[model samples]
Target chain A: MILFELIAPIVVMFALSFLHADRVRALLALSAFAIMLPAVQLLLQDKPFPLLGDYLIADRLNTYVLLLASVVGAGVALALMTLQRHVQVHPRAYFRFYRFFALFWVGLEMAILSNHMGLYWIGLEMATLSTVYMIKTNATRAAHKEAWNYMIVGAIAISLILFGIILIYAGAKPVLGEEAMYFTALLGAADRIPSPFLFEMGFAIVTVGMFVKMGFFPMNLWLANVERASFYPVAALFSGILESAIMVGFFRFSDVAKIVNFSHLAGFIFVYALLTMFVVAFLIYRAKDFMRLFSLSGIEHMALIALFWTSGGTFAALLHFGAHAFIKPALFLSTGVLESQGRYHIAGALRGYRGLKGKLFWFVVGLLMLAIVSLPPSPMFFSELYGFGSMIALAKSGHHLPAMIAAIVLLLFLLSIIFYRFVELYQSMKYEGEAVEKRVYGSELAALLLFAVGALALLLPFSLAFLRSIA
Target chain B: MSAFLTGAFLATLVAALFATRLYRLLMWYALNSLALGLLALLIGSGLNDPALIISGVLTLLLKAGVIPLVLKRLTQRFALTRQVTPDIKVHYAVVLIPAILVFTFYLAEPIGRMVGGNANSVAVAISSLFLALLLMMEHRNVAPKIIGFLMMENALFLLGTTATGGMPMLVELGIFFDLLIAIVVINLLFRREEAVE
Candidate 1:
């Protein structure tokens, strides 16, 4: 039953590619909703379910990610359904877009659910391959360049990850034979593995590959560059679903690292997260294009999630992950509508829009901006609060008082810069352009509203408790 | 036999680093992959591992034969520049290459001891990986970079085949699937580049 549910979307989307564009869009949205039913069932189940004689496992972490993927996936598909009417893509191209999107989704599922490390790597590579073409959906020169940049970086990262996986297998195979590639087996025998040094090196290499893929510090520009050039729906998925899946890979491998007494893993993640946030914060401040601003903000959010995860704040980290998953797609979807109506910059762009729909657009963008900045009533507020509290606690426990305090102060200052920049961009919005009336699609707004509601609901006590329990 | 094959593999990768023309570089990659495939077969037969044997066959058919054909076709179809010169001059790379090979041997000693595998073979595999990365970094043109990326995969497959015998058959199969899809994507991007130009 579990296997069927997971495979169904890939099969349906592949078959639907032969149909016309509208039907593909319709069925894509429909299949996303359909999958949510099983995702919820999987999420509600208590015990881990192993399949294919243990090659794949549905456990708490992956199930939680599965549910998140479903929700975000559905929202993006819905946004595509509506946003397609405005964008002038060829029907053949549109059909192909959804087909690749389906493959991307399946790849995420495979990556999240696979118990074997090799399978996980393959899943990530599959996802990367699918996105390489999807980024070039517009066929623009800039789009092709970004796609090429994304591909080269992605291949390098994937190759490094493969090397890391091989090193890990070499370290583990001595103890557990062929079963060493399996996560459960590795975790179970981590303490007994004779080659701790090799394992640690492997884990470190894997983390570096993931950091490169996730756009940490030095390699951070690829995500922003690619996202800016990509079709908006694709950008939404890049920010929302792809980032979440990559982090899931990190968490799975790091789980094994932790068991093996790999002490440097946390410090490694913290430094990169800190550096990434620092870079992203400045980039966000200077972002002139709306998509670039939002993309930079996505990097910041992912960095914070990594920080929270490493700092003994699993609950807060997962919550932030969930909240960002919903919030970013909403931001992209709303901004996409604005772009479709000829506004894609941070300068006084509000003047170009008029009417109740225009007001709703500004209002949606404002609320999402607030949510992203972790303002009150948004779940991010609590996530950041708890995340910081945990970071300080981690510091105290490790007796790195001065260093931790300094890091926290720097992070706080960066956050303020980002928040202040968002405000400046918003305020500057009121000062420009000749007012042109625009009609916003109800379906687009509805998709945005669905995600907005999900973000807000994540703030509720019940949702917090549910997320904590999952964490 | 294993050492000889690995040495040949390393030789092809080194030769690839110096190739100044498109066809010569692709020929080097194909030979590099052929060496890796033969090494996998030799090790698999010695270990009596059917999975490793299958992986070797697949590697030969796909990496050594099919992928190069596709890349060759892409170069022809796109009329991409045939005279390839890496941005990092050959003189500098000549110095850098031997340094990497020596350093990796030192680095892989402990890993080889831990895995109970041949330290020299592991070192060769690791060095080849670094050399492939250097190959990618030096090239400014797209075809050589793509070949460099594929060479990195060959280097990794060599590492896994030598260091751990081979990964599970399913994982090896998946990697091949990814490689095939990557070629399709590369072909698309080449077409797009030509269109843009």
Candidate 2:
């Protein structure tokens, strides 16, 4: 039945999690396959698949994100095969590592599929719990600090969302009873809820929690700190899988606003998006490290995504995520290459990598940044264009006002900040003409090329339809 | 009875705000969860809800008993410094706590409109959330930070039992699972922290 098909992947991945230490690679590969098979299967189908009487549903958004998450999961596993040499691990430890990694994988899958608020909370908590272990793979002082900060912050965020969920229950109990927290049930009964004000309060609270989970503005600092501490593969899962999962949470929360015509939710999204755009633009200039710089760019991308979502461009939102998810792991792991080789000089001396290996890394990283900045030929460029167009459309639909004008002003400020930093960095490098040469290791060239192709392929006009027209 | 129990639970968290000994903080958490459990049980009996009754027993057995015992053993296993007050000055905390309570009371006015039960209890539950966040923001040490997280969960349980009269059974079970697993993983991280030290 449909239930078995949906449940099999998690069950298999959970089983693989118990593999012995020597089978760490196998455990990882099988876990990736477990996630991918069902994801690909779902993607191939045009219809939504609901299981457990609609508590867990796989729709266009969920399936597309799953396929995207699996791609990142596979990329991380594949990249690890070549790059995991630096992490020396005993058999027992290796087994333990993969077990938690598999759990994190399964958790993300569950989170996307969940329709019941309760199931969604559990899935997210599972992912967060596993991440605490993942970030601790390096037992250094800074890593420990980052891990604890991550754990504490995640706990707080999850609890806030839970409180919000309970509020939804409180508000809906009289009309819909306990089933009010179930997405399917709530859909039919949302309007009959006791008070609209309480409903907005709950939705707003949940959105705040999602914002933190997605690492925007004020909560953005934690991602960089945690990434700096995590193993590269584990961090890739976060950038790719976990971040997208949180975006789904955002989409779902925003859908409630759409269902009930709650203007405050739209206003909330616009305010945070503008503030995040303006704030991180300045913060990116102050980033002292490369990973930190990339992490800050994540906020910018998320902000753009928020803009499109608030403007009601559902397809644009999905396309932006598709582009970002595929491209981020390559960008993240290349930075891993630079950091590991001790040659990741950001905006400093013209001490760049030389020779073939250096040339490949330099080219890949440059391409990644270009994609991040949404230059032409990159998928993000198109997505950003669509986002702006949609915002204008939203304005045409009676949404433009003093607030939208202020948002545009904020956008202009963000543009000036970004261009200013680029000029500064360019001039700084120009001053130090003699660049340092650094060596790259393994199939670095082939991997970067592969990633580059994958990223570029997402931008094709037809491929955009694949995601945009998703169910 | 439910209101008194929830109030006693909030009191433990406030006391923990001032307590310097880590062991005492854990005990306070245990007592806080015990109050939450009793409140759940009392509410279940009053409403005649079997799901709430099951939730109450689980809260009593796991959060009140098992989790604190695990944390106690964790506290004893390492020569960890018992940091009761990690960062914020007492005067600042003293002023902040009441401000949080009042702010949440105002917050409850909007929240109070949706509740099917006592509006004052709803205000208290919402305030407990702020108080828990204050506990977290006030501390810097890992142990106290972790305890602050536990306190947050306890506050949420109060929210569920009082505001909604208890969530569906399935939701409560998922929550308890998360709390327990979080502690286990956190204990591992603590061990690694000790090893790093």
Candidate 3:
């Protein structure tokens, strides 16, 4: 069962490529959804098994990530179906898109579930390569450039990671005595590591490499370019699912190394997270393109919340991850719809929607606005509350300053204002007469409803417990 | 054993310096790899490990013989006649290389004491890594970039063999696989660049 969950997606994706018919692609996606439902249930049971002599394994921490990937995978398939219906592209290229997206999804799953360092490295490389193709799927000049930047940076990061892995193995050889690079084994024998200084140096380099891949500030210039150039569904997966996997990597490393106390690292991460949120908030104010604005906002908020997780705010982090993953894609997909109708500007789209007097569009806009801004009863609100509570706990433990915690909360509140203020400006835009007829289909509407309701219900007890376990 | 390694190391140093002549870079790389392979062979013979001896011989053939030949062919195919001018002039590189070598020896002395291994091996590995970086920074062309990447890999291999007495065979295999994939990808990227031009 464990091996099946790990390898099934890769096999399914490879098989999907051989199927030429659109109907088959749709069926494959439905089958994927069916496979996912059982997999997530099994994962929630928290069983662990090693495959191929500890090279790969499944555990509780990755179970949540796999479930999230599955949901996003299914959602992307549905969105792709909508895209195929709307765009008059050739069937060959369209099917290729499906095939590549499936491969990308499966590769990420493998990356998250990998237990051995070398296997993890391979999985990450596979995921990066697959996503490169997705980024260049449309083959625009901008897409090509973005893909190039992503690939080069990704390869460099992987090389550094590999180097770090070698250093760790060298450092561990005296104690473990040969060829034992499994995470659990390493963690169990962590105290036997010979040179603490070398270990720290290697860990720092590895962290920086992973941080670059995670799109943290200063290393995140590639994020906007890639997100802007990718198709909407691809962008959605990049922001929602893939970033979560990178976060899982960070979490796993921290769990294994126990190098610095979470609070100490959280202090450094918190400062950058705040800077990212503020900078992105300012950019969002000036952003004209709707998709770009949402992408920037997603990057900002995700970094801040991820920092919160590092501060021992695990429950809050999981909640925010789930909420953002659900809401951001729906919003991006709507932006795609607007873009498809030739309304590139957010202000213009808002004005046009008003002219059409579309209640459904307004409802989606309202739900997303509420969700992104973390209004009451929204999953985001609860997540942020728990994050703040964790901050307070850290303060009481004397690991963090109370004043600093208060300031971060204040900063978040102000950032929220900036986000909604743009929505206000967008809503208030003067009408240019109905620019393009809205052609939203039933599938899109169903996807939006599913995301909205799903985001709301994810705050329930069972999910909260799962979040806490992994936190 | 120490005396033999010392002589081989001195020969390698001389060869590396003399290889600055435009026509002799491949010969220099071969000599460097030969010295490394011989060092590995001596270490293995001292440890009485036939597997390590086999690996050492394989390295000598692959790195010393095959790789340099391939690089020579690549240089010829590209008509890359322009001599590589070091970012630091050759005279300056000569001076800087010894300074780096001395510094690395100093840095690795304490580590060598702790690990109870040859300090010179660690120093050589560090110097090779620095030299590879220098190689990469000095050259702007694709061929040189490939050479730089290969040199980095060679340095890493040296670190694996000398510092830790050869990483797990699985790791060695993984590194080899990664390098193979990287080279293929680099070739494809260069092809795309040529097509664009």
Candidate 4:
């Protein structure tokens, strides 16, 4: 069951790439793989399996991440299908795009499931390499340059991570001795490891590298450029799924290694997150392009919310992760459709939309806005509330009180107004001037509904408890 | 054995500081790798492990000899001009080198006592790290950056050997494989750069 859950999507994706049929068939294969996720989770409940000389493992953490990946992966695949239909001229590269997307999805899942640090590094590199190709698929000069930047920065970060891994292995060898690269073994003997300074230093370096990968501020130049240049489906996955997988890795590191002194790490991340959010908020106001603006805002908010996780903000991060996972992709997919109809600017796209009524487009857009801004009864609202509580609790405990208080106040004020503006935009019918001839299909609506229902269900007590335990 | 290892460490450090041009940089890398190889051999001999000795000799031949030779060929093919203007000026490096030396010695003292190893090995390992960082910062061209990266890897290999005697064979093999792949990727990147130009 364990190996099947971990390996099935990878094998299926590879196999699907070999099929010389329509790209829609590959989409079906992806959906089928996504379906296996819940079944696998059901079987792996409270059961752990270590495989391949302990290079991989199936545990609660892996299961939770796998579930998240499957959910987002399904949404992305569906979004891609809609995009392919909308953008009619790009027929030749369609299969290739889906193939790369499928492979990227598989690689992300593997990275999350990897137990050995080396395997994790390899999985991450594979994901990076695959995504580079994806970014270049648009065939624009700007896209190529962005992909180049992504590859170079990603290479540097991965190399640093490898160096950090070597340092850790070197430090741990005296205590844990030979063949102890697995997370479990290292964690088991973390307390006894000689040269705590080396371990801490390694952890710090690795964290910085991973932060670069996660699109944290100061290292986030590549993200905005990539999102702005790449296709919308790609933007959605980069913002939604890829970011979450890296977060899972960070969460696991915090759980097992505990290498970072939380207070200090939180302080560092908080400052950057706040700065990023402020910059993004300002940029959003000036943003003429809709997709770029929302995607940039998502990246900023992701960094901000991620700090909650570092500061012992638990249930909040998990809920926000799920909420954002559902909403961001829907918005990006809608943006893609708009772009296909020769409307590139957000204000233009929203204006003169006479044909898209009671369709999946508006419904998806509405849900996405609600979720992104964490409107009432959405999982994000509860998550943000809980996150603030956690921050307040930590601050009261005398851990960087001023910074935490400032972050809370800033997050609340910014998010509240952002939500209000989004709601206002959705309600206004100013963009109903021209009719959109091609109507959105039933399957796309089903996919959007699936995500909306999933996000709503997550707010339930039973589901929340289940997810919290696994996470 | 300890004395030989200490001598190699001192020689590598001196080479790193004195080396000037690209050829000198390669030469300095060779000397550093050779020191690492000898240290690995000594550790193997001390443990009475034949396989370790063989691997040590392999490290010496491959890292210290063949790899540098290959890098030299690549540099020649690229026809990189001599680095007349390094990122760090000579006077700054001259001052920085001694400061690093002093700092490493101070940093390694307590660590050496705790780990119960030769303090000189720790000092050399730390110095190599700083040197590698310096090499990376100094170079602007792609080829030199690749060389700098390779040197950093060699430094890490030395740190592994000196700190823990040597990592598991699997890990050593992984690092080597990673380096091999990295070199290929670097070459590809250089090719792309040429194409763009």
When only chain A is evaluated, what TM-score does every model earn? 0.95, 0.89, 0.89, 0.88
lDDT of 3 at B57: 87
Q: Candidate 3, residues A1-471: lDDT per residue as tens digits?
A: 656654665577667767887567767667556546645665756457554567667777777777777776676667777776654445665666666666676667667777776667666766676676676565466766676667666765665566566556666777886644677777787767776544544555566667677666666556776878777777887777777776776676666455423444555566767766666677767766766777777776677666667667888888888888888888877666666655354444644443333557657766686678777778988888888778777777774576766767667676776667655755643244356455666667666776787787788888888788774
The TM-score between candidate 1 and the true structure equals 0.96
lDDT for B126 in candidate 2 is 80
By lDDT, the better pick of 1 and 3 is: 1
Candidate 2 collision pairs: A351-A436, B20-B84
On residues A1-471, what C-alpha lDDT tens digit does candidate 4 reach at each position? 545555666556656655657755655546545645653554356556654557667676666656766776777676666565665425535565656666676567667777777667666766776777677666666766676667666766766676677667766777776655778888787777777766665666677777777666666556777887888778877766787767766676555444435555665567767776776665555555666667766766687567668767777787787777777776776676555456443443444333544354665666666667777777877888888888888888885678767777887777666666666555542253344444565556656776777778787888788667754
Tell me the spans in candidate 1 whose CA falls farther than 4 Å from its real position: A21-24, A340-344, A351-356, A430-434, B193-197
Q: Is candidate 1 or candidate 2 better by DockQ?
A: 1
How should the candidates be ordered by lDDT, best one leading? 1, 2, 4, 3
DockQ-derived CAPRI band for the predicted complex in model 4: acceptable
Give stretches of model 4 more than 4 Å off: A15-35, A42-44, A51-53, A82-107, A190-194, A256-288, A341-344, A351-358, A397-403, A413-447, B1-113, B116-155, B175-197
**Candidate 2 lDDT by residue in tens digits, A1-471:** 544654565566556657664555655565555666767777766566775566778887788887888777767766665555555444555556566776786578778888888788888889989988877766568778888888888888888888888877777778887778777677677667667677777787787887887677688688877887776666667888888888887787677666665567677788888878877898888876667776777777788887788788777777788888877777777665555534345543334667777766676666666666666787777777777777777776785665566677778679667656655554554354445554566554555665677677776777677777762
Per-residue lDDT over A46-165 for candidate 1, one digit per residue giving the tens place of the 0 to 100 score: 758875568788887788787877888888778777655767666777777878888897788888888989988998899999999888777688888889988998999989998999
Fnat, model by model in order, equals 0.83, 0.94, 0.13, 0.17
> Which lDDT tens digits does candidate 2 get at residues B1-197?
76688679878988988888898988999999899889889989999999999999998999889988888788788656786664778888898888888888898886676574568778887888887787777776777878888888888888888888888888888888888789888888878877777
Candidates ranked by DockQ = 1, 2, 3, 4
Question: If you assessed candidate 2 against the hidden native complex, which CAPRI class would it receive?
Answer: high
Model 3: clashing residue pairs?
A: none
**Interface RMSD for candidate 4 relative to the native interface:** 3.2
